[model samples]
Target: MYDNYAKVIVKGSPITKSNFKLFNVNGRAILPMNSGKYHDRYAIYEEEIAFNARSQNPSKVLDEALIAVLKVYYKSEKRHPDTNNITKSIFDGIEKSGLIINDAQIRRLIIEEFYDKENPRFELELFGESSFSMDYSIKPREILEEKITYNPPSNKKKALNDRMNISAIKPKISDNICEVCGKGTCKENLISANKGKTLICRTCFKKLF
Candidate 1:
């Protein structure tokens, strides 16, 4: 079986599906601006994953089925969003990023969550089609941790440190709206930002700083 793995460090508090509210626009259902903004934050990391996937030759379309396993470490000062919703957002982000041709190709999926103060990230493990049956009963994080710990890699700590060391930069302006405030629009340099993470309004930004 062909197996590949990737680790993505996510920025900001994890967004859940419940954070999104659908509203009508010209008789069509659409997500509110805030939800789009949140999802977009996570979407930026798609490029990072795509770049790392060069060696894996991630199939844009799968000839055979595969099982996808995801383990998420959520970082935040506040309580985290619901687990199911976090997984939903991750699935959407990965699909949009072309991590897989479609999430549907995944015959089996495993999800687990952990809390991290300094480094919040998601680790993905893709097992290529095999003649053997896929095991869905194992706890993803426990097994992964056991393997990593027993066969420790030298770069493990350094990698975690690098992900946690991201500094605040300027927030991008999209259609004049600050991604964080959702209400604040048309202001350039809304707030200090983290790469691939947050975009808040000056007001909220000041509050945090």
Candidate 2:
């Protein structure tokens, strides 16, 4: 029942995101960077996948939760990349291509691995969840605009009273009011002035100093 779907095929040896080398810095072991080979391969793979995804000509990026089915083909069966790592690279490429807002939008993912002697590639299929009805008329940009332009109702009086109550409950050095501006001051912000005889807020203290 998933009518909304898009397919992308990236031709090349699929790369995984988990390949990294460990190094010791200042007597502490750290594995902070990916291997040079992985970095270079991933860069090219991501670019190719983005191009393929854009070529699909999807009406708009799917905003709702999605289901991804990934088929990873390797040149040899002796070495196989981690399924999760492959999925990560694909999701990142899809996001970079603007096929979706973010990879977190994918709620379900399915992956399969195979060996191809001549042709090694990644085949990806994305679909809206069967339970939800996807509206092709609403673009992801429009959805973002709706969210950004939305303004929630605010009660200024209630907010002011809440702040006043919070300030009242806090410990104070003096009267909890700034001497110079007569604004509310907390204990942490109050500074002693005139040989501990008067207290002033940090702003007034800075001005005097």
Candidate 3:
């Protein structure tokens, strides 16, 4: 297992043995495991920072679905939405479209399963577990957060994902209502949100935004 960590990291994944670890069978010594079966990882998290089209706010997943709907409605197989250029007009289209899932529980389905890299087209299965992801990688929000340093990606799709971050943020207009109050916007009401949409109250938007 130690060798596996070395080999895997040696192959790639700069995670050192110290970084890629779990308790050993004896339950005291920490050792690196290669199975990559960490449950907390690949699972949606309360404090987990999501940084992509398929992440950020759970409801934002609908934005992706609407994009697909636009492609179909327009009868085009190739579409590249300038998320950097989303306007109130585009948002209205998403809100009016029947494909939108307003409920939070269904959110995991859309982001985790439906819009995933493997399944780009819509596939709404009733009984299935959500896709697993890790919080370790900073690639998702690497550009947005200034404190961290990031190395750019070489893969074509990853390069695309890396480039299109939620840059179209609008400042909060309301102070009384928590920006994320009714929405499943944050881990808890502990936050509203500010991925650039939905006016987040000053209190909620301050820390993360």
Candidate 4:
């Protein structure tokens, strides 16, 4: 059933894994988060796991509903909507719902899905190595605070200075390497404007064209 949804998303148009694209993590399936940050905006697809209204009819009704929702998604995103008998109405829920994703993948998907730079301007920090800054942009603030704590008074001032220092600068996204080739470039090198993770440089990018 779920495969059906993936099928719709993959087969709706002339696009496929090679040409078709969807915002996804390097090693994960499913689009990360298109729900946006708005409180009320959301996807209307419904994937029902259990039902009591009659099995056969329910599945058919669900298929129709899912198809209708996918139609809306395809039109808005200009990409195909993947739906199947097993596809849920909405992938994630509120609070923790609506596109369950980690910080690294979320940032990667964000740059891939939204960043409007004509030329890909930046990349996300995927690897946290010694002597380098942590992926502060996508890394949750709560986690950071927990790891580094300062005493009050003099230490407090030192902490503020350090924290401000990190926030003041633009992030270097050379952290997230390309899963395909394992060699990642700085943010200025990526090209995600088209769609999906089908990333490539200008030279390689033209070859596809």
Candidate 5:
């Protein structure tokens, strides 16, 4: 679930970073330059991508971690470009459009390829990472009931049953023991650590420091 999301479709034949021409300077060193036919094609492609992203009208540049899903369609099956190159182009375009502060903010990326003879383009989706949440609370009874109702003779069902059994018997940290040393201790003497997820005795705490 994402609070900030945007979808943009960029129509064009995707290009890769490998297309940048390399030049030799006095035969001393090689440098990559964004000049020539490849540069022209990539410039147009990036421009189109920026236009599509701007059409969505993002209020401000997003600086938070983001997830990007890219679907690339090629005009012909014979033409195959490196997915990483296309992804780089898309990210630069999105940044240029002021949709995101920088491409480095993208933490997760998914790319899928397909052939579309009629229309070749890139379908892009961006999601803010702040919207992601993790739920650790478990209800064994509810989970068991759901599993039993589905009752598929699969390994997944077996795994779920095992997990339920483990959860049911798992001891609480308030069991009057030092989890680190596996020794009995008074509950009051046990200090909470790791945001109360773990309980350790004062002796262990001193040793740790």
Candidate 6:
């Protein structure tokens, strides 16, 4: 088994999953085909990657178990493709490049995407079954920390679930109290804001607005 690394630098944007159109045939949802722009870019990627692989002059393709790890750095921040979608596109390109007999031979796959404003390219690392079993000591360190106020996809879903589950933990807006300002006002006349999560009297809402 072997461990190999190759870099492919291409000029165009990668195709995203959203670029395909869905058709309903016989009540079944089917993805008809990728858009023409996607095919065009993919063709270019295949050619460039194939040339680079040949230049590197690797050994004959292994017919045994294989694994591929891909790191894709995209150039534009304007378009964010699903990370998995970009992997699929590159996988096809790798297969067409004849770097391997078929992509189906790949068992374990990992793909990541990053943003690069000036240059967009993909770096791939291929590992054979034996190479993965060997002892390796490469530990990655985080160079940057990005702090976001909102949660990520998984945490966002969890947050939403928590919010939905706390239906009984509502603010008690008494008939004579404003929940926001704690002003004495008739509850029947208080304005319900933020989908009932927050209760504010008309005066407070008007003042804040």
Write down the RMSD of candidate 2 (Cα, Å): 16.7
When sorted by TM-score, best at the front, the candidate numbers are 5, 2, 6, 1, 4, 3
Tens digits of per-residue lDDT, candidate 6, 1-209, equal 23343344444455654354344756753333345554445455556656665555455454556667777788776556667777766665666666677778778877767887777777776677755643435676568567536345775898888887775565544545667778866576688877976777788888887
- Candidate 2 Cα errors over 4 Å, as ranges: 1-3, 20-38, 130-209
**Best candidate according to TM-score:** 5
Reference-based lDDT, each prediction? 0.57, 0.73, 0.28, 0.31, 0.75, 0.63
In terms of TM-score, how similar is model 2 to the real structure? 0.51
Residue-wise lDDT of candidate 2 within 147-172, one digit each (tens)?
A: 32322236676787788998888686
User: In model 6, where is the ten-residue run with the lowest total lDDT?
Assistant: 1-10
- Look at candidate 5 and tell me the lDDT of residue 12: 68
lDDT of 2 at 205: 79
For model 4 the local lDDT of residue 129 reads 23
User: Which lDDT value does model 4 have at 203?
Assistant: 47
Q: Tens digit of lDDT per residue, candidate 5, span 62-86?
A: 7788888889999876656767777
Off by over 4 Å in 5: 1-3, 21-37, 58-60, 133-209
Q: Of models 3 and 6, which has the larger TM-score?
A: 6
Tell me each candidate's TM-score. Answer: 0.46, 0.51, 0.15, 0.18, 0.53, 0.50
Give one digit per residue, the lDDT tens place, for model 3 in 51-147: 2222312332331211121110111223323322322222222233322343222322222211223323221221112332223333576356646
Angstrom error of the Cα, residue 26, model 3: value is 69
Worst lDDT run of 10 residues, candidate 4, spans 6-15
lDDT of 1 by residue, 84-183 (tens): 7766666555665565666676687778877788877666666656643565443546444433223225679677656666432333334456565577
Model 6's alpha-carbon lDDT is 0.63
**Residue 98 of model 5: what lDDT?**
90
